[model samples]
Target: MTIPTLEDSGQGTGTAGEARRLAVRGDLTMAHVGAIAGPLRAIPPAGHDLAIDLSGIDRIDTAGAWLIHRMVQDWGAAGVPARVENASPDADRLIAEVAANDRPVPCHVPRGNSALDQLVRIGNAVFVITENIGKILAFLGQTLIVLAQTLVGRRPLRWHAVIHQCEAIGVNALAIVGLLLFLVGIVVAQQGAVQLRQFGAEVFVVNLIGRGTFRELGLLLTAIMVAGRSASAFAAQIGSMKLNQEVDALETIGMSPIEVLVIPRVIAMAIMLLLLGFYGSVMAVIGGGLFCWVSLGIPPVSFIQRLQEATPLSDLVIGLVKAPVFGFIVALMGCYQGMQVTGNAESVGQRTTQAVVESIFIVIVLDAFFAVFFSALGYN
Candidate 1:
């Protein structure tokens, strides 16, 4: 069983200056809440701005303060301002804290766009593209400067770093590149053989495989692999370093991060791509030969003879020429995007994806350009 309890009472009035004053009184607490309801209701409704004086208040709990808070809020909502003017330091603090906590947070509303807004967005996109192009070209210039320094013996090139990248970007990637091209070669040969068999010209499958592999498919496929693997790795690695503040630490210690990081990677890609492209072309031809021998009953010797005649040394040279260019573009694009990373894990992820996509796009565009240029020059 429990006994009911009530709070200490208080008074409120209109003063000589005709100021509406609500004098807080009694031990206002949660348990005695029922006692204050009549007094609170007794206070006259808004004749003027309400000034609450807390001087007479003996005690208060959060509930009592909130009751006072509610009186002020209700008065304010009714177009009358209410303030606690004579509260004790502690009472003032409680009121202030409650007020602070109860304050409404502002909501943000997105603005509706007009036609001008759409144009502004397009303008912003173009500006960003121009800015990105400027940065990439600046990075290219810096890479060339570093290369020049290496050639003139002004700066020691990190041969060790280059070798390590070659192992990673080139040697480790060989198996995948070879396997994909080999499967592609088998498919091409099988398809070509099936069609040519109608005219009793199945032996021409070797010519088709050799010409396609050497002229276009070999280097392009190898570059796509490098873009997917090595480019993403470059962006991720550098972006991680940026996130960790290691790039700043490098500058603090008097090191050029471009030379230390970018130079080796760029050089390694150029060298490794040449070897990888050649290796991929050879594997594709071998895969074609295997398919020819097994499925078409064309002898390996006949396949080889037709391949040598079908794809001349000039075609191989043209493909090899494109390899290092693709590699340089891949590495440069990767490093450029990596350097653009802000100090965040999300930025790292975004930059890495951008690096792979941009590198692949550029590689394909360059491949298309080469095809046009060679056709115009009668290289085929």
Candidate 2:
């Protein structure tokens, strides 16, 4: 029985009959093995002259050659003589010698799609995002309800947890923040003094630092540190719980993991960020004042006077206002990434890193948004 001719319409220098040429191109890895198989096995049985051009082939492995061999077999089975051409020296020798008896293998067939497939793909994506958004909103609402309940529930604040978190978030962080803020204040004050001195307005350095620190620096610095410190901690803790399936166990036991695990930590972070902002403002002013007095020869009383005159109460309030929002975003990102963690210890570490990076990024973005918003509202 004569096997039907397999049509070949791939790119070559000439038309189909003008010296038939078969080209194999693209990755030689398993990814394209099946794609190559199709054209190769479809060679016409009436082939007068055929050349398996490996010209476009860049890299090749055993799998690639096996694919090519299958095509050659089909040509031979069709009683059409075919010779491999343009083969790399290595590939040519290998194909002619080793894989000469290479038999045709069945190509992998991809799962077919039906009408339901289109619906499923679209519906699943829409459903997942909707569900996730709902979860996030519910999480926020439930957290707020829990916070309100705690305030009125007549249960004394969990001073122990609060104190523990304070020590970890505030006390343990004090030295690093103090040192950094001190240096930052000095740098900012000195820089401002230099420009002000040019205009004989050096005393304004005090006002600059005072207003800038309380209105922005204190909050920004505190949020950044917490994003790095506390957000990372949340991710690590929750990721560890996830790794151990503790979150699952909590869910199974009828506990709202968001309530039990997430809310308290978020609340603690918010409180700690507020305190840190206050502390940083004080420290930045002190350091900035010292820099102005000693380095710029401005008197302490004069510096304080200028600062009080230049900085407004609104600046202080604005800075404090941002703390809870920032804390909320940081904590939420940490918990979200932690919940997404899978795999192993490596995944935990990776998720922790991602959580901190994402938290910091989100913080900066929100800070910018607030800056522009407040500017428009005439609050800054």
- Candidate with top TM-score is 1
Question: Model 2, range 202-244, lDDT digits (tens) per residue?
Answer: 8778888988899888889888988898888888999999999
State which candidate has the highest lDDT.
1
lDDT, residue 340, model 2: 74
TM-score of model 1 (CA atoms): 0.73
Query: After superposing candidate 2, which stretches have Cα over 4 Å from the reference?
Result: 1-142, 145-159
Worst 10 residues of 2 by lDDT: 1-10
State the lDDT of candidate 1 residue by residue for 258-306, as single tens digits: 8899989998999999899989988999999999999988898888888
TM-score of 2: 0.64
lDDT of 1 at 13: 47
Off by over 4 Å in 1: 1-114, 197-200
Model 1, residue 146: distance off in Å is: 1.0
